[model samples]
Target: MVSAGLYWLLSLAFLWGGFVQMGYPGMAGEVCIAFVICLFLLRFILVKRFVAASVFNVAATVVFFIFIAILQAKGMTGVA
Candidate 1:
């Protein structure tokens, strides 16, 4: 139960981040993709698939950094 709750919180945070990033001109579609990935992460956690959830979480983190790097390379200056 505690683990599930923690995972839920993390997923919500990711969703919130995605929403906040949606206003950036080149980021809307990427944010949507992140939202979907976070949803799946939430589903995996809720279903007690810890292994899959962990794997997804790692993959999501990697993908997120990749996106950030891409944005930086594209000269996106704002943190928003």
Candidate 2:
């Protein structure tokens, strides 16, 4: 529960940062990541499916890396 809360907070922070730096178009990946996190939270809370939640968490991490790769390729990097 605590970890899930922390992940949720981190997702929100990333989404906000993405929106602020690059606007709505750049937030597409963040939105998908956030959706996966929400699903993970729902599965964990309502269904008590730890394994499924873990899978979702892994998927979200993979997606996040892919998003970062895409951003890097585009030279965004969120450095500004």
Candidate 3:
């Protein structure tokens, strides 16, 4: 369970950093790598049947990223 938690925490952190720093393509790549790591690590730690966990993690990360992007766009427009 500890490994699973670590996987999730790291994945979320990467996503948060990626969304906040979208101007950095390198960080985006790192976030993708982190997502893949979470998928494999969670599978190994939570048992093979826990595919839902990985799927949920990916879905949540993507959703958050989209939300951040929309907010950033609005902020930029207002600033301009």
Error in Å for residue 19 of model 3: 0.7
Clashing pairs in 2: none
Residue 73 accuracy (lDDT) in model 3: 63
RMSD of model 2 against the true structure: 5.0
Q: Per-residue lDDT for 26 in model 2?
A: 58
lDDT of 3 by residue, 21-46 (tens): 55553345454445556655655676
* Residue lDDT tens for model 2, 1-80: 54555556656766666556554445555554565566556656754445565555555566556766876787656553
Worst 10 residues of 2 by lDDT: 23-32
The candidate with the higher lDDT, 1 or 2, is 1
Angstrom error of the Cα, residue 31, model 2: value is 8.2
lDDT of 2 at 65: 63
In Å, residue 77's CA in model 2 sits off its true spot by: 1.5
Ranking of candidates on lDDT, top first? 1, 2, 3
Which regions of candidate 3 deviate over 4 angstroms?
24-80
Query: Which segments of model 2 are wrong by more than 4 Å?
Result: 1-10, 22-51
